[model samples]
Target chain A: MSEERTEINSLGEFGLIELLTKNIEIQQASTILGVGDDAAVIDHFGRQTVISTDMLVEGIHFDLMYTPLKHLGYKSVVVNLSDIYAMNATPTQITMSIAFSNRFSVDALNEFYEGVYAACEKYGVDLIGGDTTSSQKGFVISVTAIGEVAPDKFVKRSTAEKGDLLCVSGDLGAAYLGLTLLEREKQIYLESPQLQPDLENQTYIIGRQLKPEARRDIIEFLQEQDIQPTAMMDVSDGLSSEILHICKQSNLGVVLYEEKIPIANETKEMALKFSLDPTAAALSGGEDYELLFTMKQADYDKIVLSEQISVIGYMTDISEGAHILTKGGNKFKLVAQGWNAFQQ
Target chain B: MSEERTEINSLGEFGLIELLTKNIEIQQASTILGVGDDAAVIDHFGRQTVISTDMLVEGIHFDLMYTPLKHLGYKSVVVNLSDIYAMNATPTQITMSIAFSNRFSVDALNEFYEGVYAACEKYGVDLIGGDTTSSQKGFVISVTAIGEVAPDKFVKRSTAEKGDLLCVSGDLGAAYLGLTLLEREKQIYLESPQLQPDLENQTYIIGRQLKPEARRDIIEFLQEQDIQPTAMMDVSDGLSSEILHICKQSNLGVVLYEEKIPIANETKEMALKFSLDPTAAALSGGEDYELLFTMKQADYDKIVLSEQISVIGYMTDISEGAHILTKGGNKFKLVAQGWNAFQQ
Candidate 1:
């Protein structure tokens, strides 16, 4: 990084926002107005709009010691977009509000916006209105995503039927394993400044943690294949926890098979290296940003043709309760041991 | 003010969210689904949707020493609603995301939500969605408001003409005075515990600061009177600064009269008590969530009929520049010393 530091106070809040958003091009036809104004205007004439919000606090959601600011910006946008995709909606616009202390310079903010712009370019979403202010301590980010879906195509998490088959896109546990590796490396670097991080060998898992992508492609594929999920959500708080959320909301029970859970080979190896159970890691590890849904059994044939998806379970009557069947022929109740920031 | 305190960790994140949002009745016909889903869905079929977001950090935007949690919650939501009304739109829904340290308890959160619920009821807007998580330090709030306006009825800050008359709703500078009084009381209390705050005579100004309301009524009155503003914005950052924004965006200039500025008698007295200029306070002191707008000269008669409205200025040619005409007939260029959070 170059040492050319520019004080944020030199340019006022409005100046900084204008500088950052100057090159943002509106690609969504629904967005009638963006940035520059008191509020953004959108005209989604025939489609229903979906809205979701998320906040990430420094030291709570991420550590600056191990995470790059650019990656942080990208991941922040991706996380909010995941919620939109979880509703089977195509994200059209986002408003990003950030507060940072004076410890950061203007160049540092430029790098963060570069990542934000890159994400906007990749997703073809417009950057709308936002508030930029100062924080008393570390950095804080809040993002709100707006999306559009056909009136009859929007999905909810409380409409799954008892005979629906549970499905998830992409492999699980990699992001959590990646987080463990990064935390370990951060500890080693803190103890001895001369030791460089041995991150080359763990590139895949590290990328999973640092740059997880929202499954917009999955939503598109489901639409192309004419498959409408009965209930859907993103695997942000782990597969087991998300499954339990769907079942509880739908007033049904579920039976998940341990062997059917898809854990990447690299993630499984890393879990064992840390002396952790691979199955448990896949079940309870969070932040994968993958789509998890329940579809009718009749739609199973259409989904099985896609290699990116895995069928892990099936919904059952409410009397059966929620449980996981082990490969060794044992059944245990599934509990939500997902990561909670307030646990300490 | 209750002595009952329940630890947040005992109920977990999901339980706490459920408890907070269980009774959030959806009042807007546009809101299809709320709270329980991954994203809330709204159907604004023929109307143009307006979106705005604002973030309030604990120590930066407000001080907890004199700010009740309930009042803080109410003010946060009102500030965002003010932006929606600035666009000549009727706010329909809001998403409130908050982060706080564990020093807060469930009872404290309930108090905050009570205020949020009160604002929703008063505005007839639905609480559609939000994210609640832990912060490492003080409290943080991010609120996003969504509103709707007719396709051609929405106002912008860049549409004023040279002959338009400048108008303002309600008196200004009172919120800043209220803040000064609160800070003084806090200082006195810090010096001697036995010194009780003498706030009995400062009720009006203090209330203006702590519980500022968005001018939804002004928007309604304009619609009812068949009057549309050529340009409009909210006075969150004081009159002079907002006037400069309108002039710059609209490629015009303005001439504001000092004698015409609407400073309340209570605010003038409070400013004199603190040895501050009342006109300067009205010009630069911020946080007065009033509406500043421009209308055709022909509409002046209709606006003056309402006691709440004031005609303060008029738009001029671009070469004239923005200036304030003093009561003594002296003219001075209006510089935006508006509240810049980045300035030390």
Candidate 2:
């Protein structure tokens, strides 16, 4: 890698944007326009368009000390794409707008865009259009993802019915545990500059926090199996909070079992080592970009063959309320202690 | 109007979002889903979807001290929508993602949302989806606008031909003058807290900068008159820069007349007061939010009757080069002194 640092002012905003996006080839047929215009045009002639946006602020959503610019760029795109996937739609295009302060160089921006392009290639989504501007402070990234779905095929968070099976893709609590490990390491390094961080054992958790992928595979798997979720949402704000959201929006109650919740062995070990309950971390810890959804009982056999999924619980009548049944047979109301940006 | 400040943490991000978007009624039939979902769904059916995004960073794009939060919100939406209109499309939906620090209260957010809703209602566009997060410093807004256009009807900046008549909608340079006035007043107020701003006569220019509108009417008028532009773009980065963009993309040259460039009396007076050339201001001063387009020479009589339209100049052969004819009959190459976000 080159250590060249080019001032962004040399090429200017337009020049930089052109250089970054010049090599992008449109993969989606829906994308009629991509870059080099005031706006991009797409033709979703026979399908419905699903759109979602997410804004990631530096020092709030990421720490520059630990997070690489490329990873940040990739994660930002993934987060928004995750929402589109949660809609049970295939993401086709994304417009990413970013504002960075003078502290960053053109090379740094290039690296970030490299990550963005990598994600675009991996997901088969076109980079349509975006705005690049200078910020007065830290980096700000906003990505809007557009997906397409067949008519009446899109899933919603409010369409779950009673007796629906609650399911989640991938393991929980890993990203949150990863964050904890990184924070601890950061604190140690800050206190003692000579200290060498021992993170070899925490690779999985750290990676989960640093570069979590959206569950596009899960959506594809569901499609391959001919299964449509009655209600769905990405487990961004933790399993507990997202489940609560499904229950609240669907006007029903849920019963999630602790033992049934999928937790990676490494994540569980890390949680216990940190004197934190694994179940609590999985329930309340956020940033695990997995899919949480509910499907009718008729689709259970179709999904049961998949090893990447877990049947956590089931939806019940509204009067039953939202609660979790522990391995010890204790039933308690689920509380949303998810990551709140406003919490001090 | 009430002097109430509510901490956003009390209601949480979800609660605040619900409160702000609760009253946003869906006006566009294409909007299949609006808010309360992982992603909003739109069915443009046969029409091509036009998408554009813009990111506004505080202290870079706006100064919150003089720019009201409401106006800022409205302007942010308008800026993105303007890009969609520049493509000769009908804006159907917008997703606005915002990042704000702890200094802002829930009331402040509500005020911003009030402006957002106002724009949505006025434009008859749906507020579909967005992400609201905590900023480390000042406010950051990113808005993605989605519009629909009939097949092959959407205009581009790169399709102008030789002999096309260059046209502009509304007057130019007022917004730049407005910004100058506000900045001067801000400096005076900072130096002497006791002095009141003497802005009694600069209302038009001030309002132009504070609340610029996208030329949706111009699009409608063009549609009604059955005139399709050869090329089009919003006059965002000044007339000279936008014209240069059109010329560069279309692989043609232009001959813009100095005397024909529309300038408002208020703008001229303000520019003169600041010891600036009015023509120069009209050429390079940006943020006008007006339409700059080129149409076939055959459509001249159709647009000539419009009071709001101005025939600025005409497109020329590539060998002619892009140049502006001065009022004194001297021709000079058009230089792009557009707002470069990266310039120190």
Q: Quick one: best DockQ, which candidate?
A: 2
In model 2, which runs have C-alpha deviations exceeding 4 angstroms? Answer: A1-46, A338-344, B1-45, B338-344
| CA deviation > 4 Å runs, candidate 1 | A1-46, A338-344, B1-45, B338-344
- i-RMS for every candidate (Å) is 17.5, 17.1
DockQ of 2: 0.18
lDDT of each: 0.80, 0.80
Q: What proportion of the true contacts does each candidate reproduce?
A: 0.37, 0.40
- Per-residue lDDT of candidate 1, residues B156-252 (tens digit): 8889999899999999999999999999999999999798888858888999999999999899999988899999989988888889889987999
Between which residue pairs do clashes occur in model 2?
none
Candidate 2 C-alpha lDDT tens digits along A16-133:
4444334444444444434432123344666667788888888988998888888887888888788889888888777777888767765566668777877877787766667777
In the order shown, the candidates' Cα RMSDs to the true structure are 13.1, 13.1
State the lDDT of candidate 2 residue by residue for B209-242, as single tens digits.
9988989999999999999998888988789988
- How good is the docking of model 2, by CAPRI class? incorrect
Q: Show the lowest summed lDDT stretch of 10 residues, model 2 chain B.
A: B32-41
- The per-residue C-alpha lDDT of model 2 at residue B210 equals 91
